[model samples]
Target: MLTKSSQSVATIKAEDASKNCILVFDPDKTHAGKLNAILDFLGYDLLLAHSREELAHQLKKYPGLLTIIITGDLSETEQQDIVNIVAREAEHILPVVLYSVPAKNEQPVSLRYPPSWVAVKYPIAHQEFSSALDRVHAHFAHQQTEKGQRPAHLFRSLIGRSPAMQHIRHEIEQVGPTDATVLILGESGTGKEVVARNLHYHSRRRGKAFVPVNCGAIPRDLLESELFGHEKGAFTGALTAREGRFSLASGGTLFLDEIGEMPMDMQVKLLRVLEERTFERVGGSKTIKADVRIVAATNCNLEQMVADGTFREDLFYRLEVFPINLPPLRERVEDLPLLIAQLNDRMEYEKHFSVRFSPDAVSILSGYSWPGNVRELANLIERLGIKFPNGLVEVNDLPMKYRSGTGDGVSHDSQLDFFAEAAAAVRSQPFAVKTKPTVAQILANGQDMKSYVSEVEKNLISQALEETDGVIAHAAKLLGLRRTTLTEKMRKYGLQRPREGRATG
Candidate 1:
């Protein structure tokens, strides 16, 4: 009977020992002992580390550690140092929980730290700590699932691992092999063309040409001839017979970019060709069969256009068979680091120059609205590569407006006024004017000349800043203004760098 009782006790102790352990680091030995006692009573194994070296040793010793809890006595710098060390030494990224006593004027702990890092106040109740720990565990599990769900490669050109991107990849996989008409919708610079190419590359027509035409860029009169070949002497400038996009893209894919910009008349013709799979060249009687897949993309809302009577309802339905909407850069901020890395790689390959962005620089970028989206990011990366050329991009290297998270610093009222004036100018001008309107003529039109001029000045400054990747001195030089004068204007316009006390260099 005694032997059986001893075995039962040993088995209970062994089971208790098998529970997951948490590593705690506290400078105050008494406080540490108190925490250990509390945790022990709650059936958790605890490992205490009093110094940096001891913490490192404990991390290795407890490979199956559930989490790390740090007490509030450490300064911000010390906390950062500990985090850095943890990041470097850990076999994998670990969830970190910080316990700090808030100052009288300090913001809430939740607001001060990101969601990925749990922050709790000192004198934490057992139940509160347990709840926080449960949340941390759930977050870590979700991260692991997300990591597993990521496809090895979505496409050669597209790069992202967020859930949004994963959905897009799944859509592409389902739709790529089919000959269905696809409509890609997104804002400008959101990689619509890249998506189209991926679909084409994966389709049955991969061996054939992938032709892309920008309907909005070509004149309406020439668009018809561009889509369908024009015969010799078909028009005043037709010197010889030339094939259109349809013939060039036969047995392949035809990408209609900015398709919403197609005129109403052209939409009818396009609908007819799509329905019949046949079209005739301009001034030619031959009916050419179009053995091509259609992939249309537009930044404008086709449904809205149809409702507005600008786009044909039938054509919209035909193209909307398979729709894919790309999330904007701002929507997928988690992909910024990956994007930055890819852009750096591309810069190195194409320009033979590269630059690395500091973590703070990336953090600042991730907070911006990214109005121009991925294209804007790519442009900025290229500019950075040119400027730094194998240098590190610190937060101060970012433009004042970007650093400040205020894009171009244009007031909402001013922006509205600028657009209003531009629309009015367009409405008043003749569609087929023989010559450009002079500055005086433009001012004579119903526009506040001063505001219009100021808008133009602001636009110029914004463009210069964008071109220089927010470098003040470079922008000032491009504008032929003294650096101080440019700085004054930036201030006057409410443009400020992301952070103060950082050099504008």
Candidate 2:
């Protein structure tokens, strides 16, 4: 039991007791005592709940009054469940502080929010705890001014355990609190949207709306009006005065995904919005003040686009106030198992078959380069779940591409050599090695691009014919080129198929 101090460290004289109370939930009594001591020292009164059930009960009676401080060890799953529960039950304005202490000599970061509500490890000093509560209190006071509504969808506590994901989470934590416009750079399937959401949820304006617009998905003609709003009679299908995403998300965030695809003309207008924080609706003269944080994401290289003059340079700089680059899936292959487990749980919940990959299957997956990043891996796992309905996916249960030795990440020369050796050892075939120049070397040597490419193509075809006992189709597959393309290149290069004379040589 925590002994309360005689005098309050902080005081809020609320006529309604329910409107000004704090709730602290701790599974560990020791940590809970530390928190209580800090609150007592700060002159703030708090209600304590030792279990989830008890916390849920208090949340029901005084949904508006409660802000939460949760600490101690809990699993990732439990943390996420509580977040979902809080989102479901609490008043939109309520804030929750998730604090934790790591085990002795252990790092205390939780990957996903499920097992622990919102985690802060131990060794947190009294001032740190007090400052955290003060921030939360300020946020709730702002919520009260704004009508007891918090940005519900935006405050999601994203959870993941992979190192790549951990790095991303840290980046979000560092960047989210500020008003800086962030540019999230990642491949198509790398969950840029999730990062955007996390940024908005953790920002000062977290209680406001977070509107996400996919730039690539929307029609180019409509994107401008969609973002800036249109008047009642702006154009066809303009039924009434409509607010744009910028207006709807006023005092919050507007996430522009696939921003690389935005038109050059619109980019200029967007630049103005960022600069002036104001925009006029189509067919309307009134300049509305924009009060939204902008977070943009792109898979394309904006610098290249700037050099080409297809994208506005001014807009690029404005949008890139802060930038985060997500590592590709292949670069973070170590995270494959954890991602697979997450996918498995998600699929099971969706009534997709509960599937488990065998150790060999997992090994094969981890070894392969995920060109499509996390999205592709997720699709592959979901597919496996269905293909192996019984949940146990064996080595053979994988696709042929996965089973093949093509995932070795070997050089082209090594691959060709391996094939040549296998043919020579198994079938008494003679092997011929091709001397080829790399594209870079050819360019550096001042050879014409067309000629250089043709020379390389000829060498590959000649080598394929030499290695396959002049078998064109098999050699085509070995080189990962179509039979017709190989044949055409051979003719173009004036290289003949190995006939009787060539075979003898």
Candidate 3:
């Protein structure tokens, strides 16, 4: 539906998009349309700084901002605002601000650009500026890349109608175009890996490989070689040189699932690769460029793991740039019908047979708790298809556990009608009131880091114990801690329930 003015847009160098990204600030609305189309056609990462605040924010957010286009006959006030923001926040790293002009000699006046910035008349930039533009190849050489390819047939779209699913799709679409690291979080069978694949499918790296590595599945001793590859005779099993997930996923995406399961020493090496964007294979001195985008997923309580000294804090912050938390099926029961349809469709396509869930059967399934999440639902659908073939599944046909739900399945006590309204809540919002001090407040107060952390941990354990009525196992689960660990922390802090005392805790 988009019509290009000329093929000249395509004639530009293919790699220019990454290095020649532009930010347009056209307060007058004069040059937005033409430039918008040109940038789109040319595959440039175009962004708009509609307000002065946005100009500063975008500069710090996207290091790939190579060029800036500011339009309108700049009044003295507007020019000063632009100069102050761009100079302060943008770092003026090869800053080349092009001002839209009416004629060649007529300068867009009064905009006394900073000494570090190069201001040029637009629609006719100086020829020498092209050389300066060429230097932009290094713009994101140290930052990130957005080289992606989208192919339709390779993956299934996320299927759901819940608010949680809608938010997830929005996030995927927003960050999919850029090369930011994504961390998917959820319980087992909640489809963490599926989210990773969806991210890759929607990303610019769709044409590249989507290499997945389950850190927990691989032995700790071999995880390093599995990720960074190995040279011939690297170890006992290294009979020949082999490419690892990082090498295999070059110019693509490396999905590190169960990242929490990665050992501590290996975590150090992985951190180096991520920070340096270069890694040498095991037993090899040759350093290779890591052109792969990282997408990590883990069901483990990484925050709790970090608190317990099990996971790396720095590595946690690194991969957790943009986190996508998947809602478990029990929390989003309204999405069951849509998820069922998707799974049934898959079964029919693959096996040439299907089973349809009647309305009552769906209601029963919704009322029943799903401990295994979507993967459980998927397995159930496949089993039903095999049992009933092309037949309809009625309420009686469902498992006893589902049929045993509140009477007619949909009807329940007014106080406990979970199936009717559970999905309305966003997964990330905690039901309990959070009255803890923010990271900013803690940092600004200049408190001792160790003492502050211990006090906070003590407070959390106390709160959890209070909420669970001094039940140790229950409170431990609520705080995502091991029962033994929580008990030890309780002893360390001398946490005890009133009247019941330490023995109860």
- For 1-505, candidate 3 gives per-residue lDDT tens digits of 1112222333434333233356677654435544544343223446665567766766666554556767656677878888777767765355556565456777535556775566655553212333334333233232222334321111466766455798999999999888999999999999888888888878889999999999999999899999999999999979999998899999899999999999999999999988999999999999999999999999899999999999999999999999999987765665676677557655654565667665446656866557688888888888888888766677788877667753232222111233222211211222221353222233235443234446666887788888888889888777655577678778878988543754444
- lDDT score at residue 349, model 3, on the 0-100 scale: 46
Local distance difference test, per candidate? 0.69, 0.64, 0.67
Which candidate do you rate higher for lDDT, 1 or 2? 1
Model 3: CA > 4 A from native? 1-154, 406-505
Estimated TM-score for each candidate: 0.52, 0.52, 0.53
Candidate 1 lDDT over 1-505, as tens digits, reads 1011012322333222211456677777756655654443233456677777777766555454556777747766666777776776753535555465568998644333334666665655433554565554444444444667421122346776556787898899899999999999999999999999999978989999999999999999999999998999988999999999999999999999999999999999999998999999899998999889999999999999999999999999999999999988765665676677556555554465667665456666765667899999989988887888766677799977667744543222222233233222122232222354432234444443344546565777777777777788887777655588678768757776534554475
The alpha-carbon root-mean-square deviation between model 3 and the true structure, to one decimal in Å, is 19.8
Worst 10 residues of 3 by lDDT: 424-433
Number of the predicted model whose TM-score against the real structure is largest: 3
The whole-model C-alpha lDDT of candidate 3 against the native structure comes to: 0.67
Task: Report the Cα RMSD per candidate.
Answer: 22.0, 20.3, 19.8
Clashes of 2: 22
Q: What is the lDDT of residue 229 in candidate 1?
A: 87
Better of 1 and 3 by lDDT: 1
TM-score, candidate number 2:
0.52
- Model 3 alpha-carbon miss at residue 383, Å: 1.1
